[model samples]
Target: MVSRKTLAGAVAVVGLLVSAQGANALSIKEALAATYQNNPTLNASRAQLRATDEGVPQALAGWRPTITASGRYGYSWENQRGTYFEHANYAASISVTQPLFRGFRTVNSTRQAESIVRAQREDLRVAEQNALFQAATSYMDVIRDTALVSLRRSDLKFQEEQVRASKDRFNVGEGTRTDVSQAESGRARAQSALNTSLANLNTSRAIFRQVIGIDPKNLSARTNVTSLLPKTVSSAISIGQEEHPSIQSSLFMVDAAQFAVKTAQGVLLPSADLLGEASLTDSNATGNLGPESRSATIYGRVTIPIYQSGSEYSAVRQAKEDLGRTEILVDVSRDSIRAQAISSWGQLNASIASITAAEAQVAAARLALEGVIEEQRVGQRTTLDVLDTQSDLVDARVTLVTAQRDRVVAAYQVLSSIGRLDYDNLGLSGARYDPTEHYRLVRDKWIGLRTPDGR
Candidate 1:
């Protein structure tokens, strides 16, 4: 069974490609920038971070005063001492209830919300890295497949030339009927290979559009991420454990869980609030002969929780358990990041070695193909010998192309594993999405119906 990472690394029958660089060439960095700005998944993650930012303000609301205004107008009929009277009454009131103390629930909840928002930022980082990685892969795939198609088409043309030459030689009694048959057979196989390569190229192009959200045009395969990576595998693993978004997010979750436990316990403690109210009422109690009344008062009250239900205790205990779970998950995330970093490091090393060997192999295969063709021309080698050598050359060149693409992809994998594959590291100068900008705008907002973007 192929390893998951290696499955897509090598094309079954690939070919060599010469990269072109033009002023308008779409570099991998530009592709990544496009993906960062246009990928739906990355954009959704950013939106989710903004939603999490709202949690901070929601938590802060617990510390703010609750103000309300109410008014009522109605008619009532009453009979007393054999006399009946109907009166219209109206009342309007405004009240404010400010929490003088909430047993530290507001403080703990606010801290928890802040922690959660931090975790969400890390989550957005993860999503960004994932989107960029996939975009890079799609870009490389299209290049590799396109090269294969070009090589196969050239091969088909060579086979066609060989078929005509063999038939002419057989007609002149310089070659046997077997030579013509073999040439024709090779031509047929080349046609089939060309067809397959064309299909693969189309598939790659479709995937490229799906991931990058743009049709590829003069895309340059220039994703070199090794410079952003650490020097050694051990160092990479260490850095990944420390800086990987998953690990950081998990750590924040642990902190948030701890604060959540505290918030839960706060519910079991005493609470205090200050209430102020002003009201004006007009009543006709004496058959439309009554004066309007207005009153205003301010009062403070505190209540000690004796016992309402056992649910609060249950909630506190559950929160403590959740905190423990989050703490353990921090270690889990660290281990996972370490493993990924080490694996990516090994892949990068392998890709570098493969590129060197593949280049040498392609050169040797091309020389061998030339020698075989000369031998066949002098009647020292069979026509099949020349065809087989050509096939070998094609395979060697294909391997080289695949190796080059793999090298770029492996470097990205290594950079991403250590959490360094980001817009800043990639040198993308496009408009940056700042999650903290939204967070800062909303954190201390006391009143707002619209979002930071006026949505």
Candidate 2:
């Protein structure tokens, strides 16, 4: 008869095997840090943010004076009354033009640029959150699939042993041939399941590499992010609307679009500028004349726009339409964020319940399987009964593992929905990318071809 001690030993062996495999496991925090540093999508978003930083300088250029220098050298020939003459002339000029007024166009344009830069910063934040969430999900997936593979392999081994035992019993006239055939069929199904699980593990590993930027090693189970989540769904939605990067970015975009409308309206107003020029000219002819002259001038210029084939008015109308569209987009972003928060909150709650139920199921299945094995040894239970109980135990254990993985992933999803999945909130240890430092370095910079860090 199968004793309780024997079943307990079997459980201990499985535990030891899992523990040995996890000795070199990678933690979730380390995986997130690696993704933050190496993810191509996140890095691309940062590069785009840096590119947006240049918009401020481009806008500020409108308020600064422009200086230009030009030089021309030419030869001239003329023929009159059968006589030919040749002359060479050289002229050089330097000019400066400073904008005195432009109906606040530069001011509104600068405001627009600044607003856009702020929006892009929020976009970068969103990208970071997404990358971290993906890494966490992939990490959980690998752990779940790995555990399933191990469970399936163990089940296959048990089924193979059951088939051998049934055959021996049938040969000795203690078991029927039908019992041996059932055992063999169960073993075949277990083998198939193991193959499927191995394939799933490979797929999970591929995704882990794609998201985490490296091959997955022994991955440890991670603590859930439930502590970082809101206590209630209402609070989660409130926080998401207030702090979600997508919503924040949309708000800034609305502001930028408003400024763009003002900038377009400014085009209809008069513009004024101060202009200064200095020039030197030299002329020489082969016959007898050579003259050199220098001149300087400073003046104020005013330009008033009257008509332009209706293009300027059309531009103002277009800008206003764009502003309206952006305002609507702000609403859209809020609705989308709210929905995500609610859905993620629901998922988290469901996963918690599933884990609870799965744990109970595993415990019950284990006891049932042990009882069946004990009964079969005393001829009370058939071989088919034992095989069915074992299969139930394997499935229950797999369900429990899957539920645990879902719980972890769902918690992270909740954090991400409310914009708290970033490195700062997670307390990930790494070199955080600071967008403000780059903005500060380049915002007022007058002249430099290279970036602040000499990139």
Count of clashes, each model = 0, 1
What's the distance in Å from true for residue 116, model 2?
0.7
lDDT of each: 0.85, 0.87
Colliding pairs, model 1: none
Q: List model 2 lDDT by residue over 243-328, tens digit each.
A: 99999999999999999999999999999999999999998888767799999999999999998789989999999999999999
TM-score of 2: 0.93
lDDT of candidate 1 over 215-252, digit per residue (tens): 98887775556678788998998888888899999999
Q: Which stretches of candidate 2 lie over 4 Å from their true place?
A: 1-24, 287-289
Could you list the CA RMSD of all candidates, in the order they appear? 5.5, 2.5
**The 10-residue segment with the lowest total lDDT in model 1:** 1-10
C-alpha TM-scores of all predictions:
0.91, 0.93
